[model samples]
Target: MIPPDNQIYIIIFSTIFLGGLMSTFVVAMVFIHRQRQAQSRQKMDQMQVEFEKTLRHVENEIHQETLTQIGRDLHDNIGQLLSLTKLNLNSSKPEKHLEARECVNEAIKEVRALSKTLNLDWVESLSLDEYIAQQLQRIQATGFCETSLQSDRSFAELKKEEKLVLIRVVQECLNNAIKHAQPDRIAIRISKNGRARHIEIEDNGQGFDTSKQSNGSGMYNLSKRMETIGGKFSLSSAVGKGTLVNLELPFSV
Candidate 1:
């Protein structure tokens, strides 16, 4: 049997030990919480950096494409009109001068139209369906292939960044079809399925094996870009069957 004084001392020691243990536990929990918060912040910062990088890349690509289109129009359309205007002006006939004035007016209009496309604001103003239709029309105008667009026109509005990324991806797909597929017919379909928007670009060209590794990084890069935008990209192809690209994006509520 312990004496009363000894009992008091034991109780006090036990109380002090328990209090110290609780303090250590609380400190450990707080440290763990703060460490997790720091990690979360770091991850979010890294994501923002990557998104900015992608945005810059998309902007550059769009600018380059705009320049190329402008160059083509200048050489093919505007230049020809100017040459005709010069020829008409050189003629002695006053009627030819009137014709020359008409040509100049037409050239002015074309220039104004081309100027609108030069600005990135057009990207924001154009809907995805409209852009796809325009692209198909351009291809058809080239007589490269028979192009078709089928759309339910139920596309949700997207942020400028999201729209830009989507436009580039679609452009890349179309280019790949023209360059590699050599398909006689290219068809694009846009639709909405439940909570997602779906686009399928299909080519009736020579398709490659999906199981085999691609010789280039184009396919891999496309997949990654879609992931960055919270979208999904899938390519299905088989020998002699042709290639189809499926793009899916969730509708933000």
Candidate 2:
């Protein structure tokens, strides 16, 4: 309204203030973006570390189990076969010699099977369903209980780490059934629906009361383990009817 020179100075000041505000806004946005990126990277690194730790734990467990199995096989299986072979050879009958040869052949076959199982790397080539089925078959072969498996799909889509975790879980369930439940029959079912993978293991055994079986935090540990993997674990049992374990795993898309 007054001097023209003053109006030009006013316009210059307004432009400077607007430019400073724009610059500050850009700097703030960049700082926030960088902060979020750092947080994401930290989270990813932590997950990787956890995964590696789990893998090592599983490997150690498997190694210990393998050693036990080898000892059992040597004493119960191969040793028995060799003893029978020696007895047959000592007999006067020619037919006994032939039986000795057959015994030796069976012993060799058993050793070969054990050798394959001794190799931890062999697990890498197996699917989760196949691994579970093998364990069920072994349990059934014991003649102490009848075992069955039902699977609608293959579980090759799961990561190796996931499969290892599941293997330990299944082993625990089987041991509990045999050691405590004394089940007459056991059933396992595996399936996938949408993004969920399901495993159901049921046994018709003399079940104990779930309310009072807190000797060593066994059940609690299993539940915590599943939660760590973003999975769900449940146990159902009665005094005499049976026990059922249901596990659900969510898969990444």
Candidate 3:
């Protein structure tokens, strides 16, 4: 057997070895935890950057659309009014002068209205359903196709970024339907499905096969955009049957 002094030394060495081993393990675990935290932070930063890029794109598209609408209004509505006002002012009759004044006033009001749409503030001011209704009404006014919005309940309020993304997606869907579908009627229905809200845009136009890959990147971009906003995009179409596009958003999101 070993001497008493040697046995005490052995016991001290064993305890020190075990303590050192535990210290190394704890250090390793802490390093792993900190590394994972850094990775998570990096991922969050990337997502935030992507979301900001999407918001910029949405803002640009909305500005372009607003400018186009303003151009149309100026050419078709305000321009005519100003011309009428000039003609009435040139006339000798006092009644004609009064009509000219009225036309000028109406034109001023229209200009004021158009000016309000020049900024991105409208995106935050308007609700989703209200915007949808306005879009459908604008389409119906064009007489290109019959458009309808059917909603029994209001949708959940979304953040400004989510609203912008959703509006852009909806606009793209309507544009595709009008440009390619050649449908007689386009119907947008909004409904609440349990914990989610659904917006369905259906057109009675010539539908293409969904199984075949699309040559355009529009659908893929739409899906990505929806995913960014914690939403889902679904499209169904057949060769002879009509096409339907559905957008779903969870209430918790």
Candidate 4:
């Protein structure tokens, strides 16, 4: 009952319709791919913002903790010295009064020493050996754990950022070692191999599985900070073998 011309027209229309459908599907796939790419970019931007915010937050927290400890040391440790000085000043004998003056001078010296630590600019300028010595002295005073430092070359030639990162990394490692590992001895070593600067913090303490949540936020932050500065971070630890945190930073000069 169909005419030949009409049947030919039907076939032509069907072909055109299928071609349009395929074109539409191709366009839709392109749109989907672009959308996914945009989403991925947004996620990366958000993560960068969050990481920076977290770093600032943690830095402020560390500053506050340091201030609090300094306050306690001044009060409990130095305050007693002040009290003794006052007692000597109130003595009935002249010799005792002279002794009190000497005591006062000693206390003032101690206060000055404590005051220097309020600002870490000196640390930025100090050699790695000197910085480590100061850190070790402070750590020893806390009776938390013993620390040692060994270096093949002086850290005076290193960049300021490198020194700060190095100190922060070691501080985080030592903190974790004391708080989590409860270590008896912590050792820090630094050396240069060709153009690479190598640093290591090792502790003989109760270690945890590195594959798990062993390092915590402090260590994680340090790792991220190191990566930002073109450095490599690695950690090795076991239940009884203790922990070893290592960092390698490329040196141009």
Find the candidate with the highest TM-score and give its number.
1
lDDT (tens digit, per residue) of candidate 3 on 95-195:
99999999999999999999999998888888888889888888888888999889965464788888898899999999999899999899999998888
**In model 4, where is the ten-residue run with the lowest total lDDT?**
54-63
lDDT of predicted model 1: 0.91
- TM per candidate comes to 0.91, 0.80, 0.86, 0.70
Residue pairs with colliding backbones in model 3 are none
- Give each prediction's root-mean-square deviation over alpha carbons: 2.0, 3.4, 2.7, 5.5
TM-score of 1: 0.91
Runs in model 3 deviating more than 4 A are: 1-11, 84-105
Q: Ten-residue segment with the worst summed lDDT in candidate 3?
A: 152-161
Task: Give the deviation of candidate 1 from the true structure as CA RMSD.
Answer: 2.0
Our tally of clashes for model 3 stands at: 0
Model 4 Cα shift for residue 138 (angstroms): 2.2
Question: CA lDDT of each candidate?
Answer: 0.91, 0.86, 0.91, 0.77
What's model 4's overall lDDT?
Answer: 0.77
lDDT: which is higher, 1 or 2?
1
lDDT of 2 by residue, 42-136 (tens): 99999878767766887788788878979988999999999999999999999999999999999999999888888787678877778888888
Tens-digit lDDT track for model 4 on 58-154?
4555566568868987898788878888898888989988888887888888788778767666556578777677777788778888888888863
